[model samples]
Target: MTELEQDEYTSACEHALTNSMNEIKQRYLKLNTIFLVTLNAATSGKKLMALLLRRLQKIDSEFLSGLSGLVMF
Candidate 1:
């Protein structure tokens, strides 16, 4: 791929990496509120969201590092 394509790929990857984090936060908070109001069990969903958050954090860090390196060139 050309430099331009690489740059675009890096940017897109960066977005994907962070997108999940945001969704995780939104879902977690929403679920928290729902549980507070309705008191339904959310153990499984919370566990899955936590796992997703951790994985996404790793991906986001890697993507940011790569994107920064590409920006340096």
Candidate 2:
């Protein structure tokens, strides 16, 4: 392939790799928050977690910051 074509291909690959890594990072953060919630639930026991979860539902900040990282593109 010509130099121009090779450069274009390299740029495209770089863009794709960057986008893929960003997506993976976002997903990893989401899963980690999920795991934390699950662990909190398990340790505190489901019933208390259920009650607390309901209470926490109204308070967005507790979990919303973590969620924002996953949502903000």
List the global CA lDDT of all models: 0.61, 0.66
Kindly list the per-residue Cα lDDT of model 2 for residues 1-73, writing each as its tens digit.
9999999999997896687667666666665665568568878788977766665553445446645654563
For model 1, state the Cα shift of residue 45 in Å: 24
lDDT of 1 by residue, 1-73 (tens): 9999999999998897686566556655654554453333334577655665665566556656655654554
- The segments of candidate 1 whose C-alpha lies over 4 angstroms from its true place after superposition are 39-73
**Residue 72 accuracy (lDDT) in model 1:** 59
Q: On a 0 to 1 TM-score scale, where does candidate 2 land against the true structure? A: 0.59
Clashing pairs in 2: none
TM-score of 1: 0.45
Tell me the lDDT of model 1 at 26: 62
